[model samples]
Target: MILPETTTVAADEWVSQHRYLRDSGLRFFDLLVAVDLGDQVTEVVTHVMSADATRRAMSRIEVRREERIPSLVEVFPAAAWHEREAHDENGVEFAGNGDLRVLITAADPPPLQRSAALEPRVDKAWPGLYEPGAVSGATRRRRPKPVPGVNEEWINGGRQ
Candidate 1:
């Protein structure tokens, strides 16, 4: 199996780098996405391939959570949908996409961001008072644990 060639570029050079790749024969736009890197930064990645499928490449740009990267819609029109999905899910903006309407959940802080609190998973009361799978009203055997990746203070109504 062949792996896609990966290139990490600065946010300002994103469009230009992709344009170079497209011009070099990786003209097939595969996908675009965002990965939440905890509370400080997010990585936006794009993949493109040659027409014959023999060559592929991935481009990545890491930016602060609030920063916006240039859009690739002018270079690859199909990037609009993927960009919108990345925007809605991770709060990363694709500047100049023009059609970045929400493609998924409308939750604040973007559901996929590492700092986002899963309210439903943390707020709902479990039937077992003491522990999961235990009988209701059972005596406490241990301290209740907070949901993974959710701040305990936040779940308790205190912001940290």
Candidate 2:
């Protein structure tokens, strides 16, 4: 029933406060869910259930880009897989989780940011330094080889 400020709490604080939930008769960590916001933010939802109705409750958290929050796997063993899924799919970092890798194992990148993939990749266009002809203020010269069969005399024939 405690709602922390900013929807995210320090890992240590969270674990300490919820330690009792472990022994509160909740046998299962139901799921770790996430909602994707196009601009690189996701809302995370963690669900837990107790065999007794009075203790059953849900916890919500938010994960943002460039932020690392603690994972609940230590408090709820069942959260291991859920944390992994959140990390893989939504790019949420579960700070304390030892393993951080894609769950699906496909070569494709995460689906969270589809627009980035569709955008053109222009960085590889130039290998190293810019070529003279490729940019302004660049000059180019071409030299033609002499012809073997026709002598200068024949070519200049009548004129000279």
Candidate 3:
């Protein structure tokens, strides 16, 4: 009954961690996408599930400004489309993913990632940072919880 935890992982470790999850009981691939954090960091998120879909965990990889993340398609083929979406929306570059082609019709700025060029990413602030307001309007915070007994080194797709 536990929702997939959002575990922050490094770009290099993404594949390995996901591979480990696949090798383990969580063999079901769920989803993958990214959020433009607007601080030179795009938070890439992916989730996997147990065969029954009851047990799952989310993995978030913080891709720093100008950093290229490795592709997860090698481990989870489903990542292909998700990575394309991230690239089309947020301009994130998944290094090994060959299909980084624009997923949708978009301009140079991309639809979802449009901070004023003159201002720093932090100063410009990502539009829709608050869905409607600071309170009940949106999920303004990360409520990610870790899976029990899953260590950071491997569980949730971090480190090891």
Candidate 4:
């Protein structure tokens, strides 16, 4: 079924309302995907199957990046994988999910968004003694200068 576009259902209600479709032989929980709108909100889409081979049903749910949405794992345990993928890729939250941290790595940054500076500064200054290619004998090797004191060390470390 095509759900209401703007309707917001309680987490439990959302799952309960769809349980019948599952029991009616809609055994496939195809995918759950989200699109990032560059703000705190995302558009989530859930696809399911019907008994008829050619028929399909989609239930869409909008979720804020900060807030949690209903988890479909209770109805279709297969949904857990899709839920985790949505959470990882688009930063969607699935409330009462069995494993919120699954399929996510600590090194992965949060979802991308527009801001004052979208690109990073590529030309930052650093102190090092090295030439573009090879230094000639006439060109004396630049002495390795100590970075002023501990303050410079701390600043560079923080940037990294």
Candidate 5:
């Protein structure tokens, strides 16, 4: 049975901590991802397992927008793609990866970042809100609130 173990490490200690975990037992790299905590910090987490898959570990490093955590590509080559995706989605930089190309959309602010606006929700009308000429004499009740994650100022040609 593989029990999950988690450790939160400082950004500067990220690479070293992963190396320590690898030396201890977790040798098989599983995956890496980023989570936006909405506190101006992005939590980057990587999961790994022992060679026999009997042990598992998860390492987390929190970094602010301006900070770049050291890349683990040297220790786990599979981390390169995951790092690129994280960078593309959340704008988290991996210092040594060297190939942090945009793996997804090329939006100015990363889409998954908390500060990034959800333009589609603002630009398009919610399907449930209106159906033109579908219902006869169905008087509207009230103004619908903007969709979640969309600013009220950008709704109904409110703001650009």
Candidate 6:
């Protein structure tokens, strides 16, 4: 069967929505995570289940890349670790979480971010650097594509 739909909410309403979920019988905190939607937005996902473990629901909230969100540690203390992982992996900042320290990579860029920003490989075609389905596996570079950081214009408007 298809999974139940997840409810999406604004970042500001996340904590309250989660509290509502708990009051509505979804008292089990399954997980809390985040997805990198480029540098502009990050989608945080939350899953909760009924105390009887028979019902469940998922919720999502989007936060601007440079913004902070309140932590749910006060509600579900177990969420501290999951939120930390999201912060470590996707560069999300939970406002009330005292431990936003990088859990995995303390120095490297977020693992979920675009690899192109960190590694320049014009010689080797990456998945999104080219048109979709243009190259299945590995293909020789036929032309010199614009590099993102070499020229400021490339990053601004040169690529287009």
Cα error, residue 113 of model 3, in Å, equals 1.4
- Specify the highest-TM-score model's number: 1
| Residue 102 displacement in candidate 5 (angstroms) | 2.1
Candidate 2 yields a Cα-based lDDT of 0.59
Best candidate (score: lDDT): 5
Query: Which of candidates 5 and 6 is the stronger one according to lDDT?
Result: 5
Candidate 6 lDDT tens digits, 80-132: 99989988888888989998776778645687754324434333334334545
Output the TM-score of candidate 4. Answer: 0.59
lDDT of 3 at 101: 79
Tell me each candidate's RMSD, in Å, in order.
Answer: 4.4, 19.0, 14.4, 11.3, 4.7, 7.4
Q: Which stretches of candidate 6 lie over 4 Å from their true place?
A: 115-160
**Lowest lDDT 10-residue stretch of candidate 1:** 121-130
lDDT of each: 0.81, 0.59, 0.73, 0.62, 0.82, 0.74
Q: Count the backbone clashes (under 3 Å) in each candidate.
A: 0, 0, 0, 0, 0, 0
Task: Give me the overall lDDT of model 1.
Answer: 0.81
In order of appearance, the predictions have TM-scores of 0.78, 0.57, 0.68, 0.59, 0.76, 0.70
Per-residue accuracy of model 1 over 100-133 as CA lDDT, tens digit each: 7866688898988887867764565443334657
Looking at model 6, the pairs that clash are none
Where model 4 places Cα greater than 4 Å from the true spot, the runs are 1-12, 102-104, 107-109, 112-160
Using TM-score as the measure, what is the rank order of every candidate, best first?
Answer: 1, 5, 6, 3, 4, 2
Which whole-number lDDT from 0 to 100 does residue 22 have in model 5?
88
Considering only N, C-alpha and C atoms within 3 Å, which residue pairs clash in candidate 1?
none
* Cα error, candidate 1, residue 94 (Å): 1.3
Q: How far does residue 112 in candidate 3 sit from its true spot (Å)?
A: 1.2
Query: Which lDDT tens digits does candidate 4 get at residues 1-160?
Result: 4542343345557787558668777677777777766556677777677646455666666666678888888898988888888777666778878786747643244433221121222233343434556655556366445554323333333364
Off by over 4 Å in 5: 1-3, 124-160
